[model samples]
Target: MRGNILQKSFIALQWKTSFTSQYLVAPTQVIKSMNVGNIRFIADAKNSGSKLEATVFQDDHHRDGRWWNISTEWKVACSFVVAVTSFFLNARYERIQVQKEIKLNRIQSQIKDLYGPLYGNRLVSDTSYRAVMKSHKGLKKYLSEARRKKDAEMIHCWRSYVWNVLYPLDKAAVDLILNNAHLIAQGEFPKEFEQLLMHAARMEFVMESWKNDDGALESAKRFDDDDYLEVSNASGLIFRTQILTHVKQKYDTLRDEQKQILLDISSDKQADDILAKIYQKVTHQDL
Candidate 1:
């Protein structure tokens, strides 16, 4: 009886050991991850407090979702900031460019008033005119350099008027000038046309000496330097010649009424009217 009781107690002890070990030991291969529940909890959780704390430990999806939201908000804010900054910068740039163009046009008008497009005739003090002309030319070069550096859109604004003025002698511009002159001088040249004629004649007379072969070569050579290349070069002469010649031809072809207007424009000495007429004669486009 004693031996049977001892044997039974030993059997019970073995079963308890086996059961405890089985409870502690994990399966050889994992059927599902323990973290899967935590992941689902964060993904589907709607409660803010539980999501904020418990979801913090979840996979990148939850963490990244939050980060993405914050990032998106920042990106939107940054976009708005950039847009406002661009608006002010563009406005300031436009204001500056417009002011520059206006200043240049004003200076050009003043120059016409002073010289009436004649080289020797002086209206303003030489110093004043020269100063203004220098400014105009300098500003033009500045704007051009800026455009070359990628500020073209800003500098040009609605149109390329700056580009047009800077390159007045370009083929297209020249064509425009000639065509305008023809129209303005169409029927009976205006007094403005007469003034244009006088100006053309004077220029022709002044440039006559440069037409001499010996003098031509010398004058051409003088234009080789940067300073002289602008207005004194052979190419410049040719360009001006074409313009003046066209104006003269147009003037000569004008009808009787146009001719009378030209005479009156010349004799009146009114700079504004004279220039307006000259502009019409030269470019056809209203200033």
Candidate 2:
């Protein structure tokens, strides 16, 4: 009985070893089964280059008698396999979600006419907006030099549309000047006249360049400089004040056509002749 038990244990060990080896070489090969009483042994061919065999012997007459013999050729085989299902899932779904978010932000920025509206209008700030406008200086200079009609028309349209949006802010600057005109005109000489005159010219230039000429004219007409005289008694001392006075008088007294002609031409004999007379009368200065 003891000998039989020992034989079965040895057979089991041999079977396990054989199964492991066979799997290590070729995992797909089916195992063959051998039975002895209540015990079973399995084996498969591995590494076909070498012909090997294993066998187990049993005694039917002796109830407690058995012996086994096995060889490496019958061992099972296996190979390493890596399943990367999680890697594919992460790439196809998780990474795609991140890419989608970035694309959405980019589209939003383009639509808003800002480089990054979601980022608090970082690229659309006043400084950056002005910088972008300044970039068109090259294009404008090129078009002017080339004198291409199509390019000129395109440039004009771009400038017009830009002023449409920016003119309101420009008008606000004039309002600031109008508000502080008294303080500025009353202050020190040379400095005060320079500042006030610059303010006045800036206002006029903005109004002239604004999209709606009639509207800008009407808006500009709303500011009254009569009180400006109260700020300074030395109005005759500075040429800037005289120039501002000349411009105001022209705007106030001239017909629409005459005003347009004066604004349009840099040097017009007729327009200058008329302005010269007005300048002599209002400011008591020769043009």
Candidate 3:
């Protein structure tokens, strides 16, 4: 019975040692395999993270390039607008300057036409005199023909010549004759003196007839009744010429006493007043 008990105890101890070794060895192998799998998973996760970062960097680079292109286009558009506006403004300024020049040229041309060539020369020579006489004769012939034909248009056309040319000539002739009265008394006359006298007589007759004409008389009456005082250059010239002619004619007819009174008048205003009185006295009407 003691031998059987010793053998059974040894078998029990062997069984316990075998069971402990099996369990411990299986757990150690499983832990090693799980560690290897975990290491592979960590490596794969690192690779995926690197790929995502590269993609994000590429996207940022593309956006930057697009923004740079847009900025370049905006600059180009601004430059184009400035260029067009500058060109337009410069063209407009040039056009205005051209128009101003044209207007100035027109005004100069008008002035040259109206007051140059004949009247602009201060010294009158024999050639100028002949030219003037020829012009006057032609104008007179034209005027007479127009009147004979009762051509209203032709008469209207001659109005400027009648005032600017014929009237001025008449005034000049009257002045020459009055100034050279002593030479005339000595039986000396200027060149074309007879022609001037003839013209003067014709002008006097024409003026008298015109003043008495129905239309002229009515116009004169209306002009006299108006209170307007504006004086044109032409009208002022005519008035001055008439006053001088009247004064010269009256002076020639004055007595020695009246002439002495006129000579003694110191100021132009006093002389004009005395002459006006003399005119009233001689004409039996206020002058």
Candidate 4:
């Protein structure tokens, strides 16, 4: 009987130790968890020396059931977050691409309809005019030495250039501005551009009057060789020729602002984050 008692005590101690070890390891997660009813059932017959009967786990089922529900809720929430992020990110990407296309189109229009023609015509006119000045000194000595055949020939060449070449090119530039004034960079027309139109108009009247007078040097005498040399390089014509330098600056600046060229572009983890960046990059800030 004493050996039997010793064996029962050892067995009870071992069972308690095992339960404690499982509780310590993962009390809430264990399938063999003990609840208050089982603890009481163990206590009621602690020393009665009866067979211990118990369920492996609690009957409540709330704790583990709630955990499974929480896990499933978290899964659904994460899926929703991913969906929302994808939707907005795609929208932001399209918006940025559209904005880029709009800007590129406007730059194209400015280059094609306005600055391109203006710059090209000015380049040709200025190049030819400068070549004449460099080659023949541009009707300067011709005025004093008009009695000589070579000087007369030089004056005739210069005069023909002023009428045929210079006037036509200036008129073409003026017409371009008139047709596309809406495309100017500023709110109002530039004074330089306006002066070009005025110069073209003034020279047109002079040419018409000279031709009407049968070309007896009528416009030349009245306008005077000295005035011709001075006013030919007037403020309007200055702006016209200076455009060879100015247009290039504006053109290249716009080109560098292009969507594909600027460095330091990056991707974002979220939609709104990158949307703000693109707005600042494409619209507000300089590229």
RMSD per model, one decimal: 29.5, 31.0, 35.3, 11.6
Encode model 2's per-residue lDDT on 1-287: one tens digit a residue. Answer: 64786487566655656576753453334344445543333434455544333344443524443322222222321111123664675478556556655644443333233211212322132344455547555333433432433333443443444355433433443454445443222133334335544644554444353334455322322323321121211112223334344334433333343344444443444666897788689776533
In angstroms, how far off is 161's CA in candidate 3?
Answer: 19
Q: Order of candidates by lDDT, top first?
A: 4, 3, 2, 1
Candidate lDDT (C-alpha), each? 0.40, 0.40, 0.42, 0.59
Q: Give me the runs in candidate 1 sitting further than 4 Å from their true place.
A: 1-68, 116-119, 122-287
Give the TM-score comparing model 2 with the true structure, all chains together.
0.22
Please provide, for model 4 over 210-239, each residue's C-alpha lDDT reduced to its tens digit, 9 standing for 90 to 100: 352565433333443443342332222345
What TM-score would every model get versus the actual structure?
Answer: 0.26, 0.22, 0.25, 0.58
Flag the better candidate by lDDT, 1 or 4. Answer: 4
Native-structure RMSD, model 4: 11.6
Instruction: Using lDDT, give the best candidate's number.
Output: 4
Off by over 4 Å in 4: 1-64, 136-155, 212-237, 259-287
Candidate 1 overall Cα lDDT vs. reference?
A: 0.40
- Once fitted onto the true fold, the runs of candidate 3 whose alpha carbons sit more than 4 angstroms away are 1-64, 117-287
| Model 3 score (lDDT) | 0.42
Ranking 1 against 2 by TM-score, winner: 1
Q: Using TM-score as the measure, which candidate wins? A: 4
lDDT of 1 at 255: 33
Worst 10 residues of 2 by lDDT: 226-235
